[model samples]
Target: MAKKVSDIGGGRSQAVHRALKRAILDQALPPGSKLPEDSIGERLGVSRTLVREALVRLSQEGLVELRPNKGAVVSHPSLEEGRNLYLTRIALERLVVETLSGSLTQEQIDTLSTHIAAEEAARTEHAASIRLAGEFHTLLAQMTGNASLIRYVNELVARSSLILALYGRPHSSECAVSEHRELLDKLIAGKTDEAVALMTHHLDSITTRALLPRKDSLADALHAYAVAEGLA
Candidate 1:
């Protein structure tokens, strides 16, 4: 059994959680990698109790898997799960665009434009580009001003990010950028039907890209992560 340390307390626990979550999202902890509480606790300078708490939070978010006797590992969504996740995301995003059409304030449009600029600036940086791509959808949901819908979209966006990390191949950022611009233009023009249709097509493109096979060995991924994190 992994030994649990109780001395570190709660404030540091949240930090542990954030660090672990960042690692997972950045694919520093790739799918199916074991998350030993002791190792993580030591790495982050937190207690095992803190690491376990962080793991629990991640599990609830569907980013970590908790096994009965084997401890925790990163969640690995199957091909079918990835398809279904994108399908659900498409439905929710369609709702987002439909609600925002003809109702977006000038300030909101400016904010979205700023976000797009940031995405463009990060286009050469793979992880940053992916994170910003997902944030674009979450920002749209936030504009709806519905807490419940925002929460749901946030979770789905995070899951979709993980799916892309696992299954997506390396490619130029131009396609996603162009698709987002088209969708934004439709929304700004108050073409609700066109915006909705474009949103559907954009999400379908993401799903199609995710379904393409990629050759990534576990050892290579882990080594890259270690070097990137200065753990090597």
Candidate 2:
């Protein structure tokens, strides 16, 4: 029972993080927008204390930058940062697949298959598809039954999603859902090496295609956003 209450703040923290992160990811907040504590407090109907705590946690996770006198701003990850993040993901997730191999259960395989199906159904639901695509790694880690690995992979996936949100060229392409389908085929066939190799290649493609910020500014971004939202 004590554990339940103790879990509440963590749950609230995740809620706030998801809300703010999605706003940033969807370009609602944009990359350089500042997150004012009191305003978010009022918008989300939470306490400033909770908002502050959440922002600090995001800062620690490399999703937000807490500056002196500047408060917290959504992190504008450079191309270097994007490459580093994906590289870390490749290393960690490769290990996850290796560990999960030969140990994966029929039940886990069924669960993953269902997730892939949902991904297909969500293709037209851009936000749903994006979230499900990010979940592919998280789902795999959880199926491996390693709590620590799941936690690490979840965080990496979250940051990676943020990066895509900030810099991804307008859904001109989609997450290679077919690659996930093939990955499942390998796992079911116990072709662990194939799955690992495919994941490496997949992430490498993302790194290669990413665009650095160049000289974009926050004011320009805000103006564009306001125009899109009919505020300008």
| Cα displacement (Å) at residue 227, model 2 | 31
Candidate 2 clashes: the total is 0
Q: How does each model score on TM-score?
A: 0.78, 0.77
Residues 1-232, candidate 2: write the lDDT tens digits.
1121222457777787778877765667767789999888777877778789889878776778899997999888775677788988999889887887677788888888898988888777655566677788789988877888888888888777777766665541265578888887877777889989988987777764443444569886587579989999
Consecutive 10-residue window with the lowest summed lDDT within model 2: 1-10
In angstroms, what RMSD does candidate 2 have relative to the true structure? 7.8
How would you encode candidate 1's per-residue C-alpha lDDT over 1-232 as one tens digit per residue?
A: 3344455456677777878877887788889999999787776666777789889988877889999999999999876777888899888888899999988899999988888988888877766677788889999999999898898898888877887777776753558877887878888999999999899988888765545534458776587569989998
**Model 1 misplaced stretches (Cα beyond 4 Å):** 1-15, 213-232
Clashes (candidate 1): 0
Where is model 1 poorest over a 10-residue stretch in terms of lDDT? 1-10
